[model samples]
Target: MIVLLLGILVLAIGGCVCVVWADRGGPRWVRAVAAVTLAAGELLRIARRNRRRSIKRSSGGDE
Candidate 1:
């Protein structure tokens, strides 16, 4: 959840940069979508990893 939110916020900042330097509003969409997808994937991965770690710890597997 936190990771997803952070990723979205980061992607939004990157999108702002893309638009600001879009040259003529041409390459704004593809890059933005690509960036958003990447961030979303990363966010999911991070959340999954954290969930696994917590599960392991709670199960006394941390030893």
Candidate 2:
């Protein structure tokens, strides 16, 4: 389990590096990886926001 978490952390860091490198005119593969990482991050952000909204509604927080 620990190994899996460490692997994920490494991948996340690598993806971030790719994003920065792409911004600085890196190779095609780096740009592609950065794009994917950015899109995935956006999707996750949206999903989390929607989940929070749903939870708030269920708890009657609109009052």
Candidate 3:
């Protein structure tokens, strides 16, 4: 489990580096990785918002 988490952390860090490099005109693959990373981040953000809303609703909280 720890190994899996470490792997994920490394991938996330690599993706962030790719994003910065792509902004400065890195290679095609780096740009591609950056795009995927951005999309994944967006999806996670949306999912988190939805989960929060659902939890709030379940607890009878008004948003």
Candidate 4:
């Protein structure tokens, strides 16, 4: 669980760095890769968070 969260965070920070680097006139390929990585990382994080939320909501009603 913690590992996943850390991986996601690391990817996210790396993604942002790529974007900044690309915006400053880095190679086209760099920019493309950064965008792709950023999107993938965000999607994974969102999915994980959403799954946790659903679990919490479902389990709490019994309390």
| Steric clash count of candidate 2 | 0
Cα RMSD of all models vs. native, in order, equals: 8.5, 1.1, 1.1, 4.9
* Residue-level lDDT tens digits of model 2 in 5-47: 9999999999999999999999999999999999989999999
Runs of candidate 1 with Cα error greater than 4 angstroms are: 1-26
Please write out the lDDT profile of model 4 over residues 1-63, one tens digit for every residue: 999999989977877888889889889887997889778878989999999889989899464
Cα displacement (Å) at residue 24, model 1 = 19
Q: Report the alpha-carbon TM-score of model 3 versus the true structure.
A: 0.95
As for candidate 3, its clashing pairs are none
RMSD of 2: 1.1
Question: Could you tell me which residue pairs clash in candidate 4?
Answer: none
Tell me how candidate 4 scores on lDDT.
0.86
Q: Order of all candidates by lDDT, from best down to worst?
A: 3, 2, 4, 1
Report the Cα lDDT for residue 4, model 3: 100
lDDT of 3 by residue, 1-63 (tens): 999999999999999999999999999999999999999999999999999999999999876
Residue 41 CA error for candidate 3 (Å)?
0.2
Per-residue lDDT over 1-63 for candidate 1, one digit per residue giving the tens place of the 0 to 100 score: 999999979977776666555545547585666566667768989999999999999999856
Any idea how many clashes model 1 has?
0
